[model samples]
Target: MSIITLSPAILDAQADGRGIVALESTIITHGMPWPQNLEMARQVEATVREHGAEPATIAVLDGTLHVGLTDAQLEKLAQAKHVAKLSRADLAVCMAERRTGATTVAATMIAANLASIRIFATGGIGGVHRGAESSFDISADLHELAQTPVTVVAAGAKAILDLPKTLEVLETLGVPVIAYGQDQLPAFWSREAGLRAPLRMDTPEQIARAHRMRAALGLPGGQLIANPIPAEAEIPRDVLAPVIEQANADAARHGISGKALTPYLLQRIFELTQGRSLDANIALVLNNARLAAQIACRMTLLT
Candidate 1:
């Protein structure tokens, strides 16, 4: 009858009314190499703590929806091979099958909502993949944002996705895409995606208030805080354009599709960009974690 499971630490923190930020586990199991992924996960959690918030990295282990993970559990999950990358569609199936799976953006949002965690931080969100019109390869993260109430802070949609299409879909679904201190929407590694953002909000207090206002207005979905990568860390759009084009071309040439395309494109982009892309990704995620933690703290005071 248990609908959700909580790690002892998270349960204790929640009981005390501490601000807790929910993180996705797929970044560990599917996003990076073993030691680096584990280390990055630890660093992100620590970043939240340093900003006076508790970190609840969500996942499903052995059929249980874990609201948070222990250090040992994080290590095991980071190193475990062949673990499933779960989204809204297959999240239930993974639990029913009693298998281990890392929560993607959508699944993480679902787990966060169930646990009453309001904030989530990630590198970037998945979106309409190239050729989605024909392939229907839209990410469940889009729909999850349309209905889930967890506020997500990320750089932007992954640069490899169809950015214009992603924004269009978000608009059509009534999901607010607020660019933080910027006029243009950020592309994952780059500071600007060359497209005007739908909304602009400069402060965490403002962002938190917007979330409250959404509830007051009976808005069903969450908001997207498009926090840009640090200026110095960005790869610049022009420089990254050809790189992304090349990666996309290679993906098409190889006929990679579905879930495999993202990882493949990322790895190839890392190679083509000489690892600058990964460096930028880490920077933006940490930046978002700090901002999300601040917002969560403000939300606690406001609510």
Candidate 2:
């Protein structure tokens, strides 16, 4: 049985050798509430199209792994309750069980690779959780970046996580952490995370070249492009720090752990910031989507 399905738009793009940027479905399924999630999904896809790239939003539906979702499929997935968040470990199992699932960063990278899409855009990647040294709760997204060959563009690791520790783990894994247009890594909602980026690239062509160079050198894993949120959209690191700390404390108080921790922290931050966090998140996501499209287009030209 054929397990992979491509939307008509993506199929046409592939046939025409046009650029295609892969997007994760969890942003729709797990990142926001119903109507907003659906609206964001549509807007992000439109952004990709406007930038001359096709958007392939990956997900699993009724035992089929879809490389791109139709408008109806995206709407249904956004509104569906309790969708399984599939990561590296359970992506295949979810498909095998004929269950509908939203792909996280790791699973999305896996699917993007399977479909020959070399670039993925997301709001942020998960990383070393706070107290990971004791809790051993690092996100699989980090490991996926260490092995998957698709370039991932995000603001950075979620701010609720331990940013320095996340960068340390990425360094240990030998992944290239490139900050776009700046020397500092970006926090999810903030332009500056107060950590120095190991590499810096100012243009999409440069990033695309770096990605190809890695493949030429036979390197495992992909690059992490820390694209900063627009200045007006950023919440500023100092302002977000206390908010994150409070949210983390709340999570610990409520005994939230594992997959539940991220959503809980994000929701709390949204409330704590009076909806500013979600606004920043949407802005950053759209920014990353535009950059991912540019990179994908550059890669297509290189190929």
Best by TM-score: 2
TM-score (C-alpha, index-matched) for candidate 1: 0.98
Clashing pairs in 1: none
Write down the RMSD of candidate 1 (Cα, Å).
Answer: 1.0
Give the per-residue lDDT of model 2 (tens digit) for 67-114. 999999998898888689999889999999999999999999999999
lDDT of each: 0.93, 0.94
In candidate 2, how many Å is residue 1 off?
Answer: 2.2
> Please, what are the lDDT tens digits per residue for candidate 1 over residues 1-303?
565789888888888888889999998888887788999999999999999889999988888989989999999999998899999999999999988999999999999999999899999999999889999999999999999998999999999999999999999999999999989999999999999999999999999999999989998999999999999999999999999899999999999999999999999999998888878878888999999999988888895
Global CA lDDT of candidate 2, please?
0.94
- What would the TM-scores of all predictions be? 0.98, 0.99
